[model samples]
Target: MSSSFRAPPIPSSDEIDLVALFQVIWKQKKLVLAATASAGLIAAIYAFLTPPQYEVSSVLRPAAINELDALNRSEIYTLPPGDALVRVGASLESYDTRLGFFRSNQKLFKAFEQPGRTLEQSFEEFNRNSIELILPDPKKANSLSAYIKLEMSYPKGVDGVAILNGFVDYAIATEREQIAADLDVIVKNRLNELKGKIDAARSNYEVDKEARIASLRETDSLRRAQLQDELKALRAQLKTGRIDRVAQLNEAIGIAKSLGIRKPSTPSALGESERNGSSSVMRTEINNQQIPLYFMGVEALEAERTVLMQRKSDDFTEGRIAQIAKELQLLQSNREIEVLNRRENEDLFLAGVQPVRAEEARLRNLSIDMSRLKLVTIDKQALEPLRPVKPQKALIILLGLILGGFVGAFIAVIRHLVKTRQSQPQSAALSMLSNSPTMVGSDTGLNKP
Candidate 1:
């Protein structure tokens, strides 16, 4: 009398009953609504507490060619308009430039100050996030914008417009100053080079002048020595000539005494005879006969010799002596050397100075005020924005509501599935108990007993 009983077949795991799932959700709808309401309320609170951010932007256009002509035409430095604007853009992109601006104008950035953070740290954040520079996209063919856009997002209560404008002016001014400094450096270096050349020329001039003076002195010394030698030789010759003349006169005087001739007489004169106080010429024939020096009277020879011996200086006898004396006197003082030594301004005498002076004058005139130069222009200045750029309350509330609905729906589904699984084993056990024949027969026996 054994009884066989089987439980009802369980539904497949793949099977889904949409109506039942909805029913479970409907039963837990209150919990779902409460969760959704809670999420939505939190979202609203957060959106309301968050501060607003204001955005200010400005546009920078390239300066005109006329604006940069002054720089381009300068002899010191030539920078085109494109290069100038590029410099400005690079300055705006520099991190140090931004930080310097912030530090110098702390009053303008007070709103960015946060507790427990240093000024630098706060500036780091501001530099990284608050500022934006919009440039043309090179990848796109039509993206070539002739201007650059600078934008800044500041928290509420901040004057973003004024700061942006000031920064534009600051960047432009800084770049301009840098250009000026570069020009100054170039000019200064060139001027120093020119000065060095001038100094070198002056030094060379001095050296040449000294060399010339030395040459003049040497020439004078040589000429003076030559003149002295000539003077000595002339004096010696004059003395020798006087002694020879005196000797000749003495000999002539001796011969004249020996011959008993007291006066000058030629051979022809000896042939003349005086007849009765009248002189008669006995020798009238033509004959080539030389006259002897001793034929002159001793008185005349002695007189001439005495004159030669009495001569103190032979210089008066020679005209060349006077000329030599004059030349030697001139050589005694070198006029050229004296003039060179007395010269106060030596640059006037230097060679090849016309071109140098011209170049120097041009460089000197190249100096100009660089502050007036304009590198970039701010085409559009930033204005005070009336509306905040961030913290959209409506969008935040809507997103929060949608997110809460999803979370609440997920919770309800999980609760319904948990309840359904817990009741499944109980239902299977009840079906098995009711269907068992052994339990039915036991009940019958219990009734019979």
Candidate 2:
């Protein structure tokens, strides 16, 4: 029986009393309409009056196409590799002085200057605020690398696209001009440096040649003086004691005659005693004076002859070597002159520079790339906006209407429930209270009244 009672008849959605709800809405139709219409109108006016925001989108190729060509043809004249040749002029140690000269370009500084800032400060500001560049990932298969994207939002009624385009054009033009001017300055400076090097090399050649010639002259003079001294010594020795070959032969013959020595026409018969006595006397005379005199004469003649011959040979050799050295100096000087002459003679004007020409070709390629740049697939484009994207008027209106209606319905239902409760069986409730013995009278004898 308790189960059959079914938990005091649970309320179902079927018993929601839709007819009653409709009757209440019909009764308050004017209020509901007034509230919904007012809220919707306010939403529409707010959407229309509010300022619109414009989003400006522009794309830049971060990296120019044909990077290899640009690199190859770029007019930048980079400094050479080693410090040995890195110097600008003869006094390579004065690098600061050279750098000071290089930095003295007023025009470049002025061009780089920004309003209300120093030149350096201006340059930093411009560099920092310049168009943001995006580099492509090498791992990707995309042919394009490095692109720049610019985002700008402007107030309503402004020509955002046109303004942004103008700014981009101005930025790119300024960068290009600056690059060209800087490169020109660098090249001219490098040429001047080369000129300085040539001057220094020429000076070195002169100094070296002069020193070598002076050394040769000094050596030759000293050698000649030494040879003269040696000749004077030989002449003195000859005057004091010179050997006579004729006198020697004559003395030998006369001595042989004086000794009664038999001339051996062929073989001769002679006593051993006589031969021995003759040989002994001759040996004794030679030991005493003749032999010493003869040997001295022979040695003096040989020494004088040797000294004269050596001096003659030395003079000849010195003259030849000096001639060769002088010729070498001339050749070296000529070679240095030729190098300078070649550099001077090279007509960098009549014939176009190979590097600049190459760069020209690259420039053409860059131009082609610039021409080809277009949005192949545009995800979005600037539109006239037939209906403004903002405001969402209908949705706003619907939401306000729904909300206001729900609130009104809730108030109406609460009021109805209160009125019905007030009118329900008050007399029956009072009679039940009066019959209960537990109910007490008021302190003023309300029960008798």
Candidate 3:
């Protein structure tokens, strides 16, 4: 019992007077209810007057594997299903493409056209606010192959479903046409490149042929010159030999005439003459180089000299000359050059010509029917929406009621404070009169010491 409990401390003045505030609000309950009702009525009227908005959406997915197989063939243009779907999505997302579609199909959006706004301006507004391109989240896997979503909003009367469907089809067609054009341009460029290579190869072949022909001509000319020179030398040697023979015969004929010889005599007759008139000498010398030219009679020597001098051509006697004449005749025309000149198709001879031509043919024949190619598969088609997306009357009314309750409570607090402030002066005067030391001419003369 000696342990004493500490007294509770006084509450701070900063604490809120929640009970007093609640009592004030209860006292002004009629005002609060009236404000809430008025706000709800105004909200209902505004909700009824606001225009309704309907939304139609369509989903685009990846094309089939077989549909993109042709485009991916040979790797000339690789377009996977995902890639094709992405391309179509990008085309759908293009503002210019949407505007172009709008311009082409203006009849579809006739309801959007009203007074005070041009058709183009209405279409611009529609393009900005109505059409929306929604892409899929990259973080999640889409089992349905949902590549993109196209959303369009319209008024109560406009047909947003039809507009969305038409635009989607138009975008796919435009993408396909672009693909075809790109393929065509690439094919043509490849063909031209192949053609240029072929032409360059042909030019190289011509240059090589000309070079070979020149080389052959040079070789043939050198050979002909050598043959001509050899032929000339042989003819000169033959002529000189004939002249030497004639000189030798003339000298022998003079020796025979001095020795009183007329007919051809053998060495034995000369030997006999030497044995009788002079010392005995053998018929044959140790190394008799040849029979002396004088051994033949002067008539024989002279006749031989006349025959050697009267020869017109050495070709008849010299076998080498006839051989040279045959070679010169053979070298008259180069067969190789003739063959090269007679070639009708020079491209055949050029290296790598056949392969180049084959490549060109392949490029030229590279084609596919684009009409059957599918760019995107419409997984979810746009449907006519029965419910309006905008003008949520219930939500608006609920928010209005909440706002009115707060406003009404605030007004009640202000009015209470003003009336309390006005009564403060009268309360002070009454306290002074009642608690004074004495009251003059009052009913009760009560005073405090």
The clash number for model 2 is 5
Task: Report lDDT (Cα) of residue 188, candidate 1.
Answer: 79
- Candidate with the larger TM-score of 1 and 2: 1
Kindly report which residue stretches of model 1 are placed more than 4 angstroms away from their true locations once superposed: 1-37, 59-65, 78-86, 93-96, 114-125, 132-149, 267-292, 342-344, 438-449
Residue-wise lDDT of candidate 1 within 320-387, one digit each (tens)? 78888999889878888888999988899987766877778887888566788888778899999878
lDDT, residue 354, candidate 1: 65
Tell me the tens digit of each residue's lDDT in model 2 across 1-449.
Answer: 01111123345757778898778776777777776777667767776677665556555542323332332344443322121112211221233332332245334334435568765565454335432323345688785433344554444564555544554443444334444465556656665655555555556655765676666666666666665565555555544332343345345445544544434211122244356643432221213332422223333434444554434223232344455445445544444444444555333322324554444444344322322322112223333334444456677678777877776677676777677668656755665666455333332355464
Candidate that beats the other on lDDT, 2 or 3, i.e. the better one: 3
Local distance difference test, each candidate: 0.83, 0.46, 0.84
Specify the highest-lDDT model's number. 3
Q: Locate the minimum summed-lDDT window of 10 residues in model 2.
A: 81-90
User: Per-residue alpha-carbon lDDT of model 3 for 1-449, expressed as tens digits?
Assistant: 12122333556769968899889988999998888888888888888899998888998888888888888884578998888988998898887788889989988888877789976798788888888888877787864456688888888878788899999999999999999999988887888888889889888998999999999999989999999999999889988988898999999999999976788766777667767975444454455567787989888998999998888976677898888889889889999999999999777788977877877777777768899899778989999887898888899999988988888888888988899779877876776766454434342433424
Alpha-carbon deviation at 180 in model 3, angstroms: 2.3
Error of 1 at 43 (Å): 2.2
| lDDT accuracy of residue 214 in candidate 1 | 89
Candidate 3: count of backbone clashes, pairs at least 3 residues apart or interchain: 0
